[model samples]
Target chain A: MKEYQKSKINRIKRGQNRATYDVEKIDAILDAGFIGFVNYIFEGKPISIPMGYGRKGNKIYLHGSQANRMLTSLLKAKEISMTVMHLDGLVLARSGLHHSVNYRSATLFGTLKNLEDDLAKEEGLKCFMDHMMPGRWDGIRSMHQEELDRTLVAEMTIETASAKIRDVGVNDEPEDYNLDVWAGIVPLKQIAEYPVSDDQLKSGIKIPDHVMRYYEEYKY
Target chain B: MKEYQKSKINRIKRGQNRATYDVEKIDAILDAGFIGFVNYIFEGKPISIPMGYGRKGNKIYLHGSQANRMLTSLLKAKEISMTVMHLDGLVLARSGLHHSVNYRSATLFGTLKNLEDDLAKEEGLKCFMDHMMPGRWDGIRSMHQEELDRTLVAEMTIETASAKIRDVGVNDEPEDYNLDVWAGIVPLKQIAEYPVSDDQLKSGIKIPDHVMRYYEEYKY
Candidate 1:
């Protein structure tokens, strides 16, 4: 959530009856998950790829092989559009036609900037690691030069962004409302289970206290 | 799978050690989940959004409003690149630098054709419904003409596609193998809990026997 003008893309524009453009609401939805499908164009055609990304200081960062198509195209293209979304539940409507999903989605448009220097690259990697596990960065070995060179780190400025959401009861058309059809949201969620420790570790190396903290904090 | 020869795009190419080209293997990976981030571009800019999709024949189908950024941009562009991936586990190597995700992902390059007309839209909707719950199409009411006009149905043919997968032990450099770092895959999975029926269902209408079946038959 950077201090920038709110931007809304027409695609995520809510029609007459559905409109949601709240900033905190958008961040809350995004913080719930880690992976998003990123669609971009390389050489004038569209290429959508699945990627893991993290947000920090009004920017989103992604890393991949420099040889990869989507990343290569994006680098050359300089600009891109991305969406991060989560489907919370399946909305079962009384009228089959109204059946839809209860979801929260955020779409952003931005330019790609490569972090080529060593120090910046380290910070990018730190963001990546911390995103997955908040304080784990201090626990792991720092990225070495060669390993840093092998990865491509791209950052996108969060200039124009908006989040669209739909989370409510099923919208059963009047004619079908009392038809005895079962209707409601079948809540869906993404969760991390208990860690399965590495078998080769010394028998007594217990699960780190920090990792266990998430399990308790997260609602199953 | 379509009879058309499917070529693999080099941009989305998989590394020799990183590739899993088996069609069934790809299908299993795709079928294992329901939601993924979908990225695309509009006006030579990148836009990525997340959406739920289904696969049938040799193509992947996504349905949404005619105004979604990713969907609308994809519809107009016709040609698109898309990927659906799930990170199955974390592959930890003895060398921290070698750690990678044991995941299954598919990237496809193709054109998206909007499903026009009522009959085709109905069929597409059927494909979608059955994807989440088999036998649901027959159990639900058919879509009406107005409903068809309001929905956007599009499919991307799997022309040049490849599945990149990593599932087993860590790939550590020889010198680092004996460093005594604990290593293995931390398997991540989405487990399906017991189904909770809609409250409005008749008291005697217990979970349909068919709905009760998947819980016992599949892991997630």
Candidate 2:
């Protein structure tokens, strides 16, 4: 589908001007970040926890220890909601009411299922690792069978999603724009610095190409 | 109290070794970021929305338009849960099972109250703005009465909270340390670029000291 069918569940009500349901746009926002805030009901109250995720087509993969409270709770509920946001810049407006941040955020609503099959579990784990840093999965040692058995992998089939993007500069009251106040945007970015090699690395083992590639792509 | 009293509600189950209920540590995590992922129940499902917030003592302030659905719903629920997380670095391990990210995250559970008084509302708004950038509230034009009237401010008195911090280097299995794989951390940072003046700024108005100071503090 080109756009998610907007139901009451996934629709964006506030700041509708910044909302979008385009499938590609929402996917772009999701692909831009690996960590998402996943929410589940706990003790009759909703709580969000940051978790790493991987997306393949409409399915998002999440894995944790078998006893992970949040993941197990989400599984029991059989549904999930995840939000990923990237703060791009701070919009310094001429007026207090107009001050805002430039950001791209997407919220996903989906149903979840467990990846119980061993091969499927491996694939899910690989996707999760690669999503954090592409090709890092191949560079790392394969997970031992015991480690895989202790992990719980959940797959979320995204049913609906919406994104809100605010990329513009200062937005102020037209009259206030003429005031003697300075206004602008302070662009923000998440960057990577040089990698620190592990102290116990095997002798003569250089940093892998995949790790260097990730650093090159994100380094300032 | 120096620490939040932990109950089943705020207890850390999975990563107990990394969890903290110390009030000061949690406050530091909250102060380091202006945006929080706030969760609320809608249609029996939990959904998280990213919102800007300010912290004062044990109180957190959130503001949005009067018609903001999330704020209105949070007010009606009379309780709230918000999570703030700052990603510190990528921990690349020699094994996929050991891969993790260094981060500091706090989750707060609180009761919400609307700031009905004009002065309280103004204070809440000021806290929100200053949290984004220190002294930003004074740098901008004051809010008009009409603007204030259209805003909804909610104060959350935090009753309990928990934080998890992971700032250490890669931890690989003892046996894996001898493997021919490189493992380490890639430091990550969110930085500010030089400010760009708004196109419609009033003539001869230079960038304010507060704004320049923020840029200087966060710039690469």
Candidate 3:
């Protein structure tokens, strides 16, 4: 992990809205992410879209076609900001008015540029694969030069960033706490069920140990 | 589903872009969604935020603290445009260069109003809960009058709307497909895992059939 400098990070100092920072906690939350909800501007309006992504040393990589308006504009822009959020639970406060979401999110802003060469494109693809499945890239076929020519890979450094989180117990106003209202959190999580091997797998091919281990340990 | 006018929906159609859409499809996609990304000018630039939402017959319902800048300004404006999107799959084409995404999205234009009064507020709350969990309101306590007094609800009808979709396989330029590159769709889906019952539940409490049934029958 890179050391975060105060000047390099955006800080939210409001006590009532305190969930917007706490870097170590934020990094772990971001590392657990599978995708990001990318927000951008198009034709002078806002457009936000969910997209798959991977994080590297100090940058996040998201690749897709040049056809995407948001992606193309972002790649050619002066700066871009994107957020990755994990909605951990639904906070059902004692009072209806206080109900909110328990979530951990990280927002990063930086300039983005398309990955331009075969070697770099190949590395970016690995970052994408490893981000989605830690050990699957080496087991799959690698991309060739011509194959790299058609892909559009874009990378944005983690320049100005902030992590926000809210995980407190229900905060019912003092008077409402005695109203006999049900209050707590309804936690949500993501888990993979048993793996279904591909149809073309050889008969002798067994479910890999790591894959089986994930199913055994994670309840879905 | 309301019948959509083709011209209003296909305002930005790109013949070769499968992700570009016509009106009817946009309405269906929008109908399936319960939330939208609201982007409005804040301090001379756009600020996008994810908000809880609902849709009435022809209008969209969104509410928050009346103090929020985006909600207040948007409701008072002549028109505000918003976009909603769902990512379906990561299209990994034969070549990394052509990697794309299969998605369904919609953009709509409308004028909004801040809702008031007991009758409209109650109906709005019902729509919000139903949108969050289709059959959940009946399982929990209903909101009280005073609780409604502190909340805010707003509406925006669909004046002009459009929907776009991309649900195809790799569209590699012909030559790239035969270049020995791995290509196919990496499907993405949202699945509800087994529930983690509330810890404060009465001892020996059993999981309700409706909750269990929802998970069992859910395919994604």
Please name the candidate that would achieve the greatest TM-score relative to the true structure. Answer: 2
Off by over 4 Å in 3: A1-18, A177-181, A196-219, B1-35, B41-47, B76-109, B134-150, B160-220
* TM-scores vs. true structure, each candidate: 0.83, 0.98, 0.75
Q: How would the candidate models be sorted by TM-score, starting from the highest?
A: 2, 1, 3
- Highest DockQ: which candidate? 2
Candidate DockQ values, in order, are 0.39, 0.89, 0.24
Arranged by lDDT, best first: 2, 1, 3
Residues A69-179, candidate 2: write the lDDT tens digits.
889888988989999999999999888888899999999999999999999999998888888899998887887899999999999999999999999988777788778
User: How would the docking of model 3 be graded?
Assistant: acceptable
lDDT of 1 by residue, B1-220 (tens): 4222334343324466776556677777668766655656545455555567777967787888776656776778787666677777655555546667767887666678998877877777777777776765665556677777888888777666677787776676666544434455555655445555555544554455445555455434
Candidate 2 — which residues are off by over 4 angstroms?
Answer: none
Can you tell me the CAPRI class of model 1?
A: acceptable
Predicted chain A of candidate 2: TM-score: 0.98
**What fraction of the correct interface contacts does each predicted structure contain?**
0.31, 0.94, 0.13
lDDT of 2 by residue, B3-114 (tens): 9998999999877899999999999999998999999888988888899999999999999888888899889989898999999999999998888999999999999999
Q: Each candidate's chain B TM-score?
A: 0.85, 0.98, 0.85
* Model 1 residue A37 CA deviation in Å: 2.9
Q: What tier of docking accuracy does candidate 2 attain?
A: high
